[model samples]
Target chain A: MIILEYLTVIFLLIGGFFLLVGSIGLFRLPDFYMRLHAPTKASTLGIGSILVASIIFYSFKGDGVSIKEFLITLFMFLTAPITAHMLSKAALHVRQPPRPDTLNIDQLENIRDRK
Target chain B: MLENTVLAVSAAIGVSLLLNLWRFMKGPHMLDRILALDTMYINAIALIVLLGIYMGSPLYYEGALLIAMLGFVSTSAVCKFILRGDIIE
Candidate 1:
């Protein structure tokens, strides 16, 4: 039981740290394409960690291993990348500006123009 | 001990929420704003789940699920609008 408690605490803290990192990345990143990478990766891991902790905590609470949290985690994992991809595609479609040093600018434009 | 940990985690999520809000408000482009909004809802889900755990209630899970569904749909619709300039066409 003590070990479980320790694990829960560790997971919660790690999850919070990643969530903070993701939000900071969202705020500080310079361009749309660059910014698209952070939350999709970091925040997904963050929330997944927290959900794992929740699952552990509830399972030990005599609730017979609540599966809802697992479902949420799985749902998040599946959807986060899809949303990020769609958002980036929309940004690219509209020619949202990229940072000046970003590579593949002309390549992307060429591809778009050919379509 | 668990309560304190939950509180700290909730506070961290709150800070993230504020940062997301700042980005949403100050975004220089429409896509940036949309991305920020998407991240904000995800942060909100974390907050809601933490709240549910802290409160020891299963009911909040349903609310979190609903938010997750609606948030994704709205984000996709907005992105589609940006891409095609029409959502339903």
Candidate 2:
């Protein structure tokens, strides 16, 4: 196996592991805020590494360094946080209840009522 | 070696996508469903990337990119409509 192949394999493994974790978090999290943040948190690292692996593998394919992966990576970085924020805002607007057992949400209404 | 790894990784991601689907169907709140859909598309991108690697072709990248763009836009539009009762200002 060539060095590039090894690198690609390693990165693909990492990306897959994180993507699984993210979805698991989304499935298991009790609240909207938690679930919204879960995938974005893991996806940046997960998809980012997957894209990186693509870049490395394709560049070695003699396509003269395919840059499409970089564009996807940039898009993820630029929009992930915005997506998270927007989702959270929608959750708040719709009043998706947060976890009651954990955290001191004593000021939850105060926070939600500001806008 | 790379083929085996890709196969394994793709299986793992497929499982993850299933989990996302479950959440989408069963989520308690509207936002939870949206979040699941968002997560699902992101997972799809990973799957597409793995497919490209396994197939040793760069053709799938365009699909991956298109999905990413469309996913974000749709997600944002839904969230905005829910928040303000309309998408466009």
Best by DockQ: 2
- The interface RMSD values of the models, given in order, are 0.9, 0.8
| Per-model CA lDDT versus the true structure | 0.87, 0.88
Off by over 4 Å in 2: none
Best model number under TM-score: 1
lDDT of 1 by residue, B1-89 (tens): 88899999999989998998998899888888888888888888888888888988777888888888888899999999988889999
- Candidate 2 lDDT over residue span A21-48, tens digit each: 9999998877777777679889778999
Q: Grade the docking of candidate 1.
A: high
Query: For candidate 2, lDDT tens digit of each residue in B1-89?
Result: 98899899999999999998999899777788888899889999989988998899999989999999999999999999998998888
Off by over 4 Å in 1: none
In angstroms, give how far residue B4 of model 2 lies from its true place: 1.1
Model 1 residue pairs with clashes: none
- How do the predictions measure up, each by TM-score? 0.96, 0.95
